[model samples]
Target: MLGRLAVDVAIYRDRVQVTERKSGIFIDQRADHPFSSDTQLVADATRFEHALSHALRQILKTGAYMLYEPRAVVGPTDPALTPPERALVRRVLQDTGFRRIEFEDE
Candidate 1:
């Protein structure tokens, strides 16, 4: 492989973005509406996971097959997270096939 690809993920209550560090390649998606919190930021587990998984899939689609599982540096979410929220966040990352997950300090 030419090099490793890592990414930064920012998941807000209403949106989520996954950006490849070197190329600035990214996928940013909003919830169904301005007032909707479809990403749910770890609240609605199913929707949150689906939203994140979709974004991560876009990243994978970019490289086709050469990219390794990315290490995602997930920053603090917009609405803040509780202990359970953190665990759910990890679960989403793991389910999405990220090689590693480093949650930013709050």
Candidate 2:
């Protein structure tokens, strides 16, 4: 995801001749977090949330306040995310101060 975001940033930086002052963030949450068979399922939620927060921070360097437009976060619905995990993700995005956030399962 970071790699893709890097490529996008490069493309945007090159194509943008003027300061648009508006940008959008679209996150594709298709990657799965690996866990050992012995690991408890309960721990997975926290780990995933932490990793997600770290990744988002890395992608949005200056922080969410820098984003001038709404952000959309999408993920697959096959595996499905537990309610708690989804709530955690929403909280993280909100805490980052995103002007608008939309989460959809595709």
Clashes of each: 0, 0
lDDT, each prediction: 0.72, 0.37
TM-score of each: 0.77, 0.41
Q: Which ten residues in a row have the lowest lDDT in candidate 1?
A: 31-40
lDDT of 2 by residue, 1-106 (tens): 1212211211010011111123444333222453212322223444444444544554456334434543534333333545664565456546654445444552
Instruction: Please state every model's RMSD to the true fold in angstroms.
Output: 3.4, 10.7
For model 2, where is the 10-residue window of minimal lDDT? 9-18
Candidate 2, which segments miss by more than 4 Å at Cα?
1-46, 61-65
In candidate 1, what are the lDDT values of residues 18-68, reduced to their tens digit?
Answer: 888877888996654332245445566667777776776787677744447
Which predicted model would earn the best lDDT? 1
